[model samples]
Target: MEVRRATVDDIDVMAHVLATVAEEGTLGTEPPVDLEVRGQRFRELIEGQGPSAMWVLEDGGRVLGNASVSETRTSGVLTLGMAILAEARGRGGGRRLLEAILEHARSQGAHKVELEAWTDNARAIALYVSTGFEVEGLRRNHYRRRDGSLRSTLLMAVLLDTSEPEPA
Candidate 1:
């Protein structure tokens, strides 16, 4: 699979990937919406041109996952989110995406990257920890699953050390 910066042309397939995972109730906090609507929203994100970047994993002309980091109102802090298709999980796609996001954030001068994972998502939590993220805290009952059960969320972050001199 190839991971690269996402463009507006990728919105449709990326939306489908996200919608599928959202339906599985694992990748997003919001309920799954219509595929076309999601695509439109993704288009807006691409055109918004804010302090954010998005990347996608593609293979054989199909998008398998996407990652994004959007700057929050808080200075020097960015919020990260990523999702890989169920079929693509457990094969390092998530890791690659997170690493790319972190690298991009550092280049953009972000001081820290933060994300929230469902407390029950052990795989994702472990991945974050392995990638140098620390669990900052937990938000009790922060998410409601499709089955109407509430789930807690773990707040995790990694601080970037940007003090080193740039290469000449």
Candidate 2:
């Protein structure tokens, strides 16, 4: 598979993949995220007014999954978000997407990249950990379910610096 920067044409596929994964329930918990809202948000992020960046996994002329990074100099940080199609999980697509995002972040001179994942999502947490992101902290009950229950989240980060070697 090839990984590349995503163009506006990828919005619909990315949104569908993201919504499918978000609904699959990660780690040991499932959280409620408005799929329709997320689809719209994905569109906005790509065609959004603010600065944003994204990458996609391609094979057979399709965008199977995606990852994104957004930076704010005022915040001194680059935030990441990603999702692979449910059927594509267990493949290396997510990793490739993330690696491309890291390369882009480094190109932009970001100091660090961080993301939030549901605490119960062990697979994602493991992926982040192996990719050089460490668990920085936790937010208890950060996500509320549709019925009003709560789910916690783990904050993860990877520091980017000239002093460190890049991940292979």
Candidate 3:
């Protein structure tokens, strides 16, 4: 599998992977993903000149999953999210994707990268932790699902700016 910066040609497959993963109720987004809106967003990130960027993992030239870091309201902080097809989860794709985005974040001068993962997503959390991410906090009953049930998430982050402050 190859992990690379995504282009306009990858939007559809990326959205498809997202929607497929969402159907399992693991990701933040729900099924029935709005392709047009998602495509537009991907287009902006790909075509625009900004710190935010997206990447995809492909095997035999077919996309298997995607990850992205978007500029957050706080400067120097980027929010990250990723989704991989269920069949592709066990392989090292997630790690590779995370590596790519984290490198991109550092290159863009981002101070930190943050993400939210469902509390039940133990595998994902483990992967994040192994990659230097720390569990920051948990948002209890934070998100209400379409069926009216609530889901909580664990807020995790990795600080990129670990340098010592200048002495006065």
Candidate 4:
């Protein structure tokens, strides 16, 4: 498992990881989420963001997951996003990716880290909880599902205390 900063070349694989993790592949069986759009987002974030870092986890040169940190200077917090290939879930890939991004957040002077998780994704919510994330707030109808139904989003946060131990 090698985690390295992503380049523009990593766009395709990163798109695959996102669509897979987001369940776009299994839900609609239609066109996967626009790879071109995702690729462009990744490109811009990797090339032009401040207090941010993007990384891809590869095994044998194959991308297994991707994660990024977007630091909000106003709030002194870093928001992170992690997407692991569907077939790669529960094998420690997500945990590894999150840990790596957490380290990056600490280096960026972020005392708090946050992420948004779909309320229906119990597995992901559990993962974040186990990683020390606490549900800070909720955003209703944050996203629309394939059935055209609205879903809530959970705002989770983890305090990154480089000075003392994280809350238990």
Each candidate's root-mean-square deviation in Å? 4.5, 4.8, 2.0, 4.1
**Which candidate should be chosen as best, given lDDT against the real structure?**
3
Q: Give me the candidate number with maximum TM-score.
A: 3
Per-residue accuracy of model 4 over 28-76 as CA lDDT, tens digit each: 2224578888788788888985667789988889999888887655466
| Candidate 3 per-residue C-alpha lDDT over 1-168 given as tens digits, one digit per residue, 9 for 90 to 100 | 989999999998888788888889998998788988888988888887778899999999989999988886788999998998988888999999999999999999998999999999999999999999999999999999999999999999999998966588
| Candidate 3: 10-residue stretch with minimal lDDT | 159-168
For model 1, the stretches where C-alpha displacement exceeds 4 angstroms are 145-147, 162-168
Candidate 2 structure quality by residue, lDDT tens digits, 51-81: 4677888788887888887764445478888
Task: Kindly report which residue pairs in candidate 1 clash with one another.
Answer: none
The best-first sequence of candidates by TM-score reads: 3, 1, 4, 2
Worst 10 residues of 1 by lDDT: 24-33
Evaluated against the true structure, the overall lDDT of model 3 is 0.91
Candidate 4 residue pairs that clash: none
The TM-score values for the models, in the order shown, are 0.87, 0.81, 0.95, 0.81
- Candidate 4, run of 10 with poorest lDDT: 23-32
Residue 105, model 3: lDDT of 93
Clash count per candidate: 0, 4, 0, 0
Better of 1 and 2 by TM-score: 1
Q: After superposition, how far is residue 50 of candidate 3 from its true place, in Å?
A: 1.8
lDDT of 1 by residue, 7-76 (tens): 9999888887887788766665465568788777677656766667789987787889998787766777
Which residue runs of candidate 3 sit more than 4 Å off their true CA positions? 164-168
- Residue 98, candidate 2: Cα error in Å is 1.1
